[model samples]
Target chain A: MLVIRRDLVDAMVAHARRDHPDEACGQIAGPEGSDRPERIIEMENAERSPTFYRFDAAEQLKVYREMQANDEEAVVIYHSHTATEAYPSRTDIKFANEPQAHYVLVSTRDPIEHELRSYRIVDGVVTEEPVKIIES
Target chain B: MAVTVSIPTILRTHTGGEKSVSATGTTLAEIIDDLENNHGGLKARLVKEGALHRFVNVYVNDEDVRFAGGLTAPVKDGDNVTILPAVAGG
Candidate 1:
């Protein structure tokens, strides 16, 4: 299960809404082995396409180095699906390299309501996990 | 040239779980060959049809090898080679 803060969840939803029509992607980092996502690092979608999202190579390198220096790891790797359901696509499952991360998918297909779901994609397998939002 | 190769977590299985390992090569291709000699299965993961796989991002020091020369990017002594899987999806 993904136990995440309410504000972090809101931030991700806002980011998704802001990038509607194009997929938004980012990672939430926390102390190594802590699994508590505390920092939201919004990443530029290099592809900038409605159907695909990729992190800019240089930007990814920088963020990764910063995480290493700070002894943190990406606990939540998220993206939005503007017109699809909140689930991992074939491409998402195939490209998921972080076996330990919670892959969050937000859907903003409906302007009035949004759907958010989390999953674990490891070795080409996708397992949905319940998200427990913490108010504080 | 001796260089330090930082392996990503997904590829640690090929390196006996070693995060960083030393390899000798003047070009990225040569470094990959040397790494294959030691790690065995890494080349298959990083290379495909004689080129670096599209989903794998390789960096020599601070420069992305794709922008430099793909598999032929030059490396010198003490340089850092980082291999990160592309975080991407549809």
Candidate 2:
């Protein structure tokens, strides 16, 4: 199961909500090999297309550098779906580079509630995992 | 100079299923050329029309190559280069 904090989940949901209609994307970094996501780094969707999202190349570079300097790894790479289920698409599976990181998908299709799910996309295979939201 | 290049699984068929391979080059483009020499049919999937394919993102030591200098980004011993596709779907 993928363990994460409630606040972080909320932050991701909020970011997805704020950028509703267009896909939202971001990263959550943690200490190397920790399998924990502690810091949320929001990234701009360069495409800004409701059906697609490519991180701004420059900002993506900066985020990776910052993580390197801090000795952290991108534990969770996340994006939202504005009109679809909280599941990865073929494009997402094709772009899954971080085999060890959790790929989170949030669906804000419902105005009242959002659907959040996590997956492990390794070797072009997508496997959904249980998420444990910490109360503390 | 020797550097490590991490290959995404989707494109591993060209590398004989090797996840990471070492090539010699002082620059990103050179390294890719070296890789193409060692692992034939790999460069075409990554480059198009004299530049990196639109969906490809190459990073040298965690820094995106597009901003560092595109394919001209420098590389040295022990550096890790990663190649990933620009992801999107909803």
Candidate 3:
């Protein structure tokens, strides 16, 4: 099971909506504790593409350092699907390198209509996991 | 019993454009071997010298096989195997 904050989901939806027609990507940071995951970071992907998203490694390193400084961790990595459902595409599965982190997908094909799903991907396998949105 | 394996677009050519196919095996390696026998170069596309290709991800029934048990992951009859490539755009 994955625990995400309601405010974090809202922020992700808004970002996806704002980048409609193109994919939007980001990283979700939270405490490592399982009972209460406090989302503490929001990152914007800089890669430009309608079909793909490439996270900025430098920015990611910065965030990682920041999280380390704060004693928090990067729990989930997220991206938006501009024209598809929250289910992962072939490419999404292929590129998943972090087996321990939750992969969240936001469907913004219909910006006004939002569909969010969380997954655990490793070695090309995608497993849908139950997600809990904590209200903050 | 056999398991159903789904091929992604990048590797469809190896499977002769077939999106999904069937193989018989109790473990992932056996099924992969069966696939290689049926489709030429399929094993190369997915595995290199016994290791999974860096760009290919294999999921069984929506669960990543790497985390489950890698090539030794158990496969039950009717299980679905999905192959996906790393998407790097956006």
TM-score of each: 0.99, 0.77, 0.58
Across residues A49-71, which tens digit of lDDT does each residue of candidate 1 receive? 88999999999999999999999
Runs in model 2 with CA error above 4 Å? B1-28, B38-45, B48-50, B59-87
Which window of 10 residues has the lowest lDDT sum in candidate 1 chain B? Answer: B65-74
Reference interface contacts recovered per candidate: 0.89, 0.51, 0.29
DockQ for each numbered candidate: 0.94, 0.39, 0.12
Every model: iRMSD: 0.4, 3.7, 10.6
Model 1 per-residue lDDT at A128: 99
Which candidate's lDDT is highest?
Answer: 1
Tens digits of per-residue lDDT for model 1, B1-90: 899999999999999999999999999999999999999999999999999999999999999999999998999999999999999998
TM-score of 1: 0.99
Q: Candidate 2's residue-wise lDDT over B1-90, tens digit each?
A: 899998865678889999799999999889999999999998998889888887887889868788888888899999999886565444
**Model 3 lDDT vs. the true structure?**
0.75
What does DockQ come to for candidate 1?
Answer: 0.94
Give the residue spans of candidate 1 off by over 4 A.
none
